[model samples]
Target: MEHAKPLLNYIRKHVTLSEEEEVFLCSKIDYRKYLKGQYILQQGDISTTQCFILSGCTKMFFVDNDGQEHIVMFSIEDWWTSDLGSFVSQTPSDFNVQCLEASEVIQFPYETIESLFEGIPKLERFFRKIIEQAFVASQKRIIQNFSLSAKERYQLFHSKYPQIEQRIPQYMLASYLGFTKEFLSKVKKELLKP
Candidate 1:
């Protein structure tokens, strides 16, 4: 019931749901509490569940051949996260999803989601819209990487996730922005100038 509110509100943003539908959906949701640095999904593991963050933060990242971690995205409260490629296809994931802070998430297993879609067709539209938004965000990040200066990228990131900036480690933030920690500090100093 407590976890239902956030998930219900998020879904309702993209689709209208009746009370019965809401109750049914909530019944299938499972909650998990993750400690900071704990992994939700690991590279090469199959992701069996999609999660909605009820509280705290998570980072989706991958280790490159050089053994460097590359952050693909971060999710905070009210955001959904999963290795969609793995969840949908039942294949190994290419990314690792880890908690950045002590976090609570509501999870929907892949089979449960499929069942929901089969029973509630409108839910499909809701998920489609969610995917569309994620795709657009990914495209924007790609464009920013190509077209924006490091400072500009930092500014964009700061503006979009001001709260997150203060919470995550500086080194992790630097990784997300594709810069070294020292470089990010320099950029911050420049931004602070009168």
Candidate 2:
């Protein structure tokens, strides 16, 4: 189906799948669409499915005790998103994953994904690599937050994901970088100066 290609391509990048394995994987996944402002997963709910973006963007964030929304990450096409802790443990999620644009995703239900590893042994290796990469990225972000200045962080984010800056709002981007909106504006202004 149309929704399967991106995910298959992504999986191929990590591990090769046989034709039978590909068909088996596709049969187990569900293709879904979300409208702008709709939530794929919400805070306080168990994240039973992991969504792999086929198109559009989403932001994963949580509301603090004061009701402030703190963005954790913004995801676009080709990214896999879910509350990892909640999905893995079958516990309530601490974050909300909301679509920022009309979007399509391939949903891999937790049980189905687990079962796939048994039927298609290579999938276990693929998933393990995906988790390891995600963990490493999380570690890198923590280090950067502590060591990099706001301006430096902004520059690095921009350089790495130039496309994302154009898709998301400034305030959301600022939040992901651990900077206040006003601070982000000042940083942008400073960068623009000769």
Candidate 3:
């Protein structure tokens, strides 16, 4: 219940919810604690739930044919994480969602979400807005990857997610920026200079 407060507040930012509605919403949520390095969702598994981070961080990534891991996104406290394609289609996920730290999350099953949307129409709008934001962010990331230099990408990442930079390892940050660890180190050195 206490963990639900952050999620409730986040939803309230998009729509007003009565006390009864809030209680109903919270009742459907399931809580889980994940140890560091645990996988919440793995490649090839159907993603049946969307998760809200109550505390700690997670990385969503995929392994390539050459067996290199590509970091797609990082979700931290108060953020939502899911493989949207798999979640909506009930298909196997290509991405793996793994805990970067011992973490707590509140999960909503896809079936429960559908029931909520039908019973509480306003929630449909809330989720729509959340998806819209996610889409815009994804588009921005794509554009940045194609148009921005590695140094520029690193700078933008640092500016946008300073807290995450402190929490995650430099190699993960480098991967997210589509740069080698050596390149990221060079960028950091340049950034430190006057």
Candidate 4:
């Protein structure tokens, strides 16, 4: 299916765009598909594209000094994926973006987004708002990390993205929640008990 409507509506909700402008913005993006486990980006690569997840799931994570994976974010259907700092600064990415399931996404080059901002000033405002929301969510996640217990963190995550929680894998969820697999299983059992 053409995810055009959902994508267009996502944009329209943030800023009004003429038919011509919508099509113009859409024209620059390349729609592509990836199998589960495919890597959209890897460490040390200068990422030049920002992806809009149209279907399935994707995750962004980094391997630390000890080579343990720490998930930064999970992008489900309709979410955007990219290492923002790297993409904006044209620097090598520290994280890896991997498809967690067969996925379809719209990939737009950084320059295209820059040009879109120039042509549609409202887009700049829309993205600024997006960045603000991202920042707020990041702060909330950090607070939750320190203040909430593992079970509470899992519950809060469910509250925020029940649908996403259902769709992704438990290990990935465990990684995101900063819990061991067995601990997450215990948490799930607690949640499942009547």
Candidate 5:
């Protein structure tokens, strides 16, 4: 019950849910915990659930043929993290979602989500709004990757997500910012200089 508060609050931000609806929704959710370095979803597996982070952090990324990791996104408390494509299409995921810390998440299985939409009509709109926001953020990130210099990107990312920047390792942050660790060190040094 306590674990559901964050998700309920998040839902209420976009739409109102009556107590009954909230109870129905919670009935379908599964609260799960993962150890640091454990995978929530791995490449080649179909995503059957959508997760809402209750506590801790996760990284979503893919490994290229050359075995280089390209981070797609990071999620922390009150954030949703999942392979939306795979969950929707019932296909293999190209990405892996792994815990960066021991994490607690609320999982709504695909079937449960389908039922929730039917049981709680407002849920569809709430989900749509969140997905739309995520999509817009993703598109902006794509544009930034092409147009922003590495240093500029790093600065923007750091300013926006200082907590995440502090929590993650230098190499992971460097990879997310699309630069080498050495280059990141150089960038930080340049920033420190007048």
Candidate 6:
């Protein structure tokens, strides 16, 4: 009930849902809890459900041939997390979605979502907009990686996700910033300097 507002806000940003429609949407979702390090979606597995963060954080990452994990995206409250490329296209996932902390989420399976959308065409538009936003975010991250220096990237990350540094490990943050731990520490110190 209390979680309804953020979910409603998230949906209404794309489409207005009547009370009946909101209730129908809520009925399609179920609350889920996950422990830190739990995998919501693993590479090579197909994700069948979409997760909305009611609280806590999750990261979607990929392991390179050298066995290094590169962070692709992070999801926190009001954000949606799903391997849409796999979930919608029915292909194996290239990345893993892992809970970064003990977390609570609202999970909606594909079938339920489809049913809800059939009754509410606007819901389809809402989810489409979410995918569009995710694509834009991915493009921005790609542009940053191609053009920004490691220190500048770290600064941009800090400005983008102030909570992630507090919640995630230094090594993981280093990986996300495309630097070694020592280098990231040096950069961090420089960032803190006057």
TM-score of each: 0.97, 0.98, 0.98, 0.93, 0.99, 0.92
lDDT for residue 168 in candidate 3, whole number 0-100: 96
Per-model CA lDDT versus the true structure: 0.92, 0.93, 0.93, 0.88, 0.95, 0.86
In terms of lDDT, the best-performing candidate is 5
Writing each residue's lDDT as its tens digit, candidate 2 over 1-194 gives: 56799999999998999999999999999999999999999999999998899999999999999998899888999998999999999999999999999999999999898789888999899889988998999999999999999999999999999999999999999989887899999999999999
| TM-score computed on alpha carbons, candidate 2 | 0.98
lDDT of 2 at 40: 97
| CA lDDT, candidate 6, residue 185 | 95
Q: Clash pairs of candidate 5? A: none
Off by over 4 Å in 3: none
Worst 10 residues of 6 by lDDT: 1-10
Deviation in Å, model 4, residue 58 alpha carbon: 0.5
Pairs in steric clash, model 3? none
Segments in model 6 whose C-alpha atoms lie over 4 Å from true places: 1-5
- Model 1 Cα lDDT, one tens digit per residue, 100-154: 9999999989879978987778999998998899899989999999999999999
Alpha-carbon error at 120 in model 4, in Å?
1.4
Clashing pairs in 6: none
Off by over 4 Å in 4: 1-3, 192-194
**Could you tell me how far off, in angstroms, the CA of residue 143 lies in candidate 3 after the best superposition?**
0.7
- Write candidate 5's Cα lDDT for 2-65 as tens digits: 8899999989888999999999999999999999999999999999999999999999999999
Tell me the tens digit of each residue's lDDT in model 6 across 52-105.
998889998999899988887788888888888888887899989999988888
Identify the leading candidate in terms of TM-score: 5
Put down candidate 4 lDDT per residue, 1-194, tens digits, no spaces.
26566677787888898888887778777788999999999988988998888898999999999989999899988788988899999999999999989999888798788888888788889889878988898899999999999999999988989988888888889999998889999998998999
